[model samples]
Target chain A: MRRLKALIKKEFHQIVRDPSSVMIAFILPLILLFLFGYGVSLDANRIDIGIVMQDNSPQVQSLIRAFENTSFLNAQVERDRREIEKQLVAGKLRGMVVIPTDFTRRLINPDDTAKLQVIADGSEPNTANFVQNYIRQTWVNWLLQSGLSEAMLTVDERVSIQPRFWFNPELESSHFLLSGSIAIIMTLIGTLLTSLVISREWERGTMEAMMATPVNIIEIILGKLIPYFVLGMSSMVICTIISIVVFGVPFRGSFITLAAVSAIFLITALQQGLLISTVAKNQFLASQMAFISGFLPAFILSGFVFEIKSMPAFVQAITYIVPAKYFVSCLQTLFLAGDIYSVIIPNVIGIMILGSVLFIVITRKTRKRLI
Target chain B: MLNRIKNLVIKEFLAIWRDKKSRVILIVPPMLQLFIFSFAATLEVKNVPIAVFNRDTGRESWELVQRFEGSPYFTDIHYIYSDKAVKEYINSQKALMVIQINDDFSSRINSGQQAEIQLILDGRKTNVSQILAGYVNGIIDRYNRDIKPEAQVRRSSQNAIRKGKLTASPFLSPASRSEIVPRNWFNENLDYIWFTVPGIVGILTMLISLIITSLSVAREREFGTFDQLLVSPLESTEILIGKTVPAFIIGMLEGTFFIIAGIVFFNLPHEGSFLHLYFGMSVFLLAIIGIGLLISSVSKTQQQAILGAFAFMTPTIILSGYATPIENMPLWLQEFTVINPLKHFLIIIKGVLLKNVPFDVVLEHTIPIAVFAVISLSVSTRMFKQRLE
Candidate 1:
């Protein structure tokens, strides 16, 4: 017990003495929070759309008014058609809504149908799709309300669908993205600190002296882990506070549940780092391994940025091994849905299983003897 | 003097080339990550799981179900037997949305009344929900148009109602039916791989330069060989060359290999001038090597340098417009990205590859990158000199 305590104190002293750990622990979270919160956004709002209305009809003007009212679109009037296409290629205009010259003439005559042309810059399909849908919806609503068609025989009542969203009614992406950021941040801190710890000992020639001591491998591993585990936890706390307070992402789940799940995930992340450090005693290899094993998987495979189900089947199968996948699932559900047992329980179990497997592997990889 | 610098560069190259692990580290990981991340890192949403709860037994409802099943966008659709199944599927996250057809769907449509369909989406994945709703709406809109034909329109209201039992809407006149013609320009199919593969070239080049150059001096310092190099008869300029040249060459080679792979294997379009492409890459490598040298000089350990590189990476990627569009970012953030060399390189490469832009267009983006390269080179050489002293 005393040896473990002495080793842990030594680890703490090392961490406090190293400015890099301190910088990574505190400063990195702030940078990431600011970046994820303000810098990154998936919301396709305020898209620039050009309107070419060759007709001067009141109905056409009303249709244009519908496009202007929505917060998603910024409707601009361009007199020339050639200029609009140039602007689209230049990435200035996302879409163009052209109201034809014969629009009012067709509306007056029962047999003649009018055509509205919507040309979207398909270079960016996402924005193009959004522009098409919003314009189509607006036009359909206008058609429904125009009351230009005479009523036919039979009942007028029809079936209508009422859509009710369960959680996150406004569908704000920031709320979920901030939650997933916590997983990425923890993965970064956990792998970075632990990999540095073991490899720094090797680089500075302190491992020979440390191994000469009476302490066992488990004592050393535990000592190395406790400080970084605390560091990782503190980093998590900092990120969580920033997410809730600074980003205004509601913390719907209990703090205890959040801490518990984070602890399991941090264990897996730390063990993964320790395994890299043990396998590659040099700091360069260790850090590179940490990045390849830790940051990439956590960021890409964890479903933080990309949806797992949307990926190809082979890629989806691979995401099963990524520990951050479980943590992100738990964190997002916790933040948005407030501790639904079904999600939290299964995700926690998955993380616990990964952590245990990683722990066994780290123990097998760690050794006291110096070559 | 030239021979001395050449020997120093050879020594640096041998240090990486002689070690099998270093060779693998230098070459393999970038290629592997490129292949993996290019396939993985995508914002394009496809194969979203949805559940269908059809209470109607009509032909129209069955055809609607068939239409949804046929779409490549929607996949793994579960047909729920009861309301309990709907709640369970959503709660367990098996379904992103549920398309519920009411019992009177067929009756209403058959009797010339509009039938309503309910789309209940699990809003937790908000981005997916929004896009899924758009996809569903698109399917329904197309279906709505198919029921009404342009060729069979008549002026007599009775004959129109009789002929178009389900098609004729009280509010929608046959003549005034407007067709919205949507044309997607450069990327007609909107394949995301074509977009991201070119971006991988910019990212992988930055990674190689940043990691190699940052590690060069830091590795020497960690092994206590930095002082040996300093005490040698080699000039400071030669020392800088020894550190920057090999890594710069490797970075450029890797970048060129990636571009070729993208064009040949991935079918990525290369519309811009090859001369401009190489020019942009050289300037980009210069800036990255400068940043790497600065990091190596400042960091006392290999660990610190790697961490510092990571610190630069997060912001560079976020600001680079690689994953997300720069225009979507706030005005202040967009302004901040002006200093990010990765952002400039991304614009240059992506514009060249995808946009088929001319030299003037390419030069506009490359100029800023060249400025960054100049600043980084001068500052990093100054820092390298300081470190040696």
Candidate 2:
């Protein structure tokens, strides 16, 4: 135990002394999170829309009122559809809406149907698609309200859609993002620090030096991991505070639940790094294995991108191997929703189960091979 | 002098090329990185999961739920029991969006008044949720339109009986992204993957070749073979040459794999001449390989070599526009990126590959790659002799 303590202290000193660990574990994650939070937004707001209203009637004004209602767009009148296209080059707007002259008259008559012309900036298909859809909805609502038959049933009118969202009341992206960053940062530090520790020792022949000492292989592995495990935990806490306190994301889950789940994830991450370092026995290969196995898996397979439910069956099957998946679920539940027992229990147990199996694998890798 | 230089270069190349694992290491991972990055570099949100809450417990509610479930825009799995359940689902982030129908929904629609259904979307992923909310609003607006005329002329008297809070009055038409709006909130139509992949390609090249370069001298020293090279009449410049060629080749070869992958897999385009890209990449690789050589000169052991390289990598990568846009970075960081070859190379790659921009525009960045190469290469060789002393 005394030898292990010395070794653990050495590991912590090495981690603190090496300026690189400080940068990767703490600095890089924060910068990445802040950058992603501010810049990589999927939500479109304050959009400039070019509009042509051929008919300037009160009815058309009401239809235009719908455009004013959605915070997403404020329409600027262009001379014609051609001018709207011209403005796309001038960088004036992403899309243009055209209200046909017959729009107000059509809703007044029983059978007359009105057409709205939407010219979307084809460059960004997603946002443009949404923009055009919004104008169509506004037009439809106007027609429904202006004394048409309740069952007038135009071809475009019959099969209508009403959407209601649940859970995320306001749909704040920061809440989920802040939660997920905790897992990514922890995974990064856990795998990266351990791989560096063992692999550096192997590269420097220090592993041989330690093995020549009375310390057992178990002692060596545990000693190396203990410091990093603490650092990883601290980094996770730092990130949680940033996301919750600094970023103002709400925390909803129980602290015990978070502690339990996070413990399992960190253990699994550290061990996987150690196990890779054992096989690689070299710094370059160790880091490569850790990154290819740890970081990539966390980014892709972890419920971070492309929902597991939506992925192909085979991909979903493969994601079970990624520890970050369960962590993300737990993190989201904890940060966004106060007590999600229904989701938390299974995820926590799953993490523990995965963590146990990984620990076993790490032990087997260390069982015979001290050098 | 030239013959002596040629001999040293040939011998160093032979040493690097002969090791099977090392040769495979230099060649294979780049190819793999190219393959992985092509598939994984997309920023566009593909599939979003939403929660569905149905309270009416009747046919109308069921049909409404089916529409949401069937819609491709939403992955409607795992239904919640009540309004509170939907709120819980959103709070837990188990559902990104919720579509709920009030108890009087169907009855109100039948009686010639429309019911306002509530859609609470989980907004954790701001851009994706916003895009998704637009999709939901579009579909729901259509649903409202279907029952329009029933309340219009014929059922005006029936419409008068509509409830206050949940009722959709004739005057209140909720506007959804059923309109035309501006595009490109971040990177105007340059397809976000086009921006991301080039940066990833730069990182992949840096990661593989830099690792090899950093370890080459240290590996020789660790194995006690570096003394032989030291005793040979080869000047430090010649020795540096011996080290650099293979590293440059390894980096270039990796870029080739990504180029091929881009063409075949992503249908990535090239706007500029292939020659310019080749030239730019060669210089960029030279600078980065020079950086690896500089580390090799100082690092006394393999562990030092690896750690030295890594200590540089995180900042190098962050400064590059892989995880974040460079424009958003602080001015100091932006200036720091000027020296990072990956940063210039990323711009060059994107300009040529994605935007199909002309060579002149790309030249702004290519100049930096060349300058960095010459500077680092000169400094490393000068430092090489100091190390020998």
Candidate 3:
């Protein structure tokens, strides 16, 4: 027990002395939180589209005016379709609306249906969908306001859909994205902190010297694990505070539950990192392995930004192995939907199972003597 | 001098290739990530689980429910009997949304009276919820149009009559309605895979090359071999070249492999010339290597170098307009993305693959990458020289 205490103290001193560890523990999370909270957005707002007004009729002018009134679209009027098409091809425009010259004539004549041509740059499917939906909405609003729809049928004949967005009324994406980023930040700190720990000792020839001492392998592992576990937990706390105070993301779940789940996840990440370091025994290889296996998977497969349900079946099955997926699920619920254990309990169980497997692998990989 | 540089480059490549671990690291993870990213990293929403709370026993409500069941967007539909069940489904995250129809739904629609249906969405999943809302609106819109065929006629003639352009007509045909004919160019069906595969190529290339070059100097420094290299006959410039060459070669090779994989496996369309694609990739690699080497030179240890790379990479990927559009970002943040090389390269590659962009236009985007490469390389070179002295 005394030896374990001494080893932990030494580990703590090493972390305090190393500037890089400090940067990873504190500074990197700050930058990542700010970047994700402000810089990256899934909300498709202020999309630039071209409006080619081939018709100068007053009736067409109201449709153009309706397009102009929308905050979502930045409409640039052009006289020629060819010019707008060039902009669309150049990737300058997301979509373009072309008003035909016969639009007013079609409106006056009951026999002909007036068509507004909407061409979207389909290289970006999300933006293209947004552009199409936004234009369709604008046109529908124009028709309803112009009393054009009243002539066809009475208002009672229509079915109105009242969409109520629960939990997030404004549909602010940053609320959930900020919560999800906490899982990412924890993954970075946890994996990166321990990935270099054991391998760094081996690379610097200190592991051999440590092996000759009175302490056993368990003492060393525990010593290394405890300090970095505290470090990872503190990083989590700092990130949560920033998310709640600076970004104003509501945290409805109990603080105890948050800490408990974060601890389990940090253990899994640290165990995975420790396993890599033990097997590779080289700092460079361990860090690279940690990055490829840890960070990228956490970013893509965790369903942080992308929906896991939308992915292919094989990919969706793979997400079950990604620890971040469970953490993100827990975080989104804890922060937005509160402490609903129906969601949290199963995710916590998944993380614990993965963590136990990693722990078993790490213990098997570690030996008392230097190889 | 040429012989010495060639020897150094060969040594660098062998140093990476000779190690079985590094060999596995270089080839296997990238291919795995390519498949995972191309297949998994998609924004297209599908197979959403939702709950429907219908109180009306009318045929119209059942038809609307059937329409939702037929939609490709939703596959898992839970039919709930009570309002409390709706709360439980959304709270437990068993469903993304609940469609509620009051007892008067079918009766009102049959009587030609306006009926309201409430769609309660779980707003926690912001993007998915909004998209699902759009899908729901579309279903209802089509149902509304199908049921009330007379509503398709436009009353724009009333506006015309108000403007004194024509006399009032009581009845007009359905053909007089103004409709939007949407055509998505480049990708007519808007396949999400084609969009993501090109961007994944950029991301994986950046990651591999950045790790390789960024660790080159730091690895030597950590193992105390950098001092031996400085004592050797090779100049600092030659050593830098040796480090840059392997990373560049590996990056280009990986880029080519992924691009070909995209073409063969994903059936990604290659509209523009391969010349333009390779030209843009080479410049992109140069910029990435410069940034990596800069990190390598500044970092004292391999750990620092890795952290440096991580710090640089996360923001680069986020800001590159890969997952999201750059235009959607704030004006100031959008301006900041100009310094990000991936942002420029993505445009060039996407333009080449999708738009068949002209060479001059490719050059237009490549100019930024070239400028970035020149600046980063010179700064790192100056730093390398200072360290050598």
Best by lDDT: 3
Error of 3 at A299 (Å): 1.1
Calculate model 1's interface RMSD in Å. Answer: 4.6
lDDT of 3: 0.88
Q: Which ten residues in a row have the lowest lDDT in candidate 2 chain A?
A: A149-158
Candidate 2 residues lying further than 4 Å off, grouped into runs, are A10-172, A368-371, B1-51, B57-63, B75-80, B83-94, B123-128, B150-202, B214-232, B266-272, B290-355, B364-389
What does candidate 1's lDDT look like per residue over B1-389, in tens digits?
88888898899889878877778787778787777778887888888789999999988799889999999897688899789988887777788899999888888776656788988877678888877877787677566656543322233344545655324443454325666667666666777787778777898889888998998899998888989998999888889888888988888889889999898878888776888888888888998998898888889888789888989988998888777677678888888888998987886787677776667666777888889889888998898787677
In candidate 1, which residue ranges exceed 4 Å CA deviation?
A: A49-70, A75-86, A95-119, A135-159, A367-371, B55-63, B107-115, B146-178
- Over the stretch A61-145, how does candidate 3's per-residue lDDT look in tens digits? 9889999999989999999988888888879899999999998898766666799999999999999999998998788778867
How far residue A218's Cα lies from its native spot in candidate 2, in Å, is 1.7
DockQ of each: 0.47, 0.19, 0.64
Q: Taking the tens digit of each residue's C-alpha lDDT, what string does model 2 give over B178-292?
A: 2223334223554645554567677887887788788878888877888888897877677777777777776787778877776677666665678878878888888888889
Write one digit per residue (lDDT tens) for candidate 2, span A1-371: 99999999888888777766776677767875774455343344546787787888887787677777766677787446676655553334766777877766754543444556666653344455556666655555654565332333332333334543333556555567667767777887778778877877887788889889999887988898888888877777788777777778888677877887888889888888888788887766676677777876686667664355545456667678788888887887677655668777787778788778888887776776743
- The Cα local distance difference test for each model comes to 0.80, 0.67, 0.88
Task: Give a tens-digit lDDT track for model 1, residues A140-247.
Answer: 666545533322111222334466666788877888888888898898888877887798888788987888899878788899899889989988988998888888
CAPRI rating of model 1:
acceptable
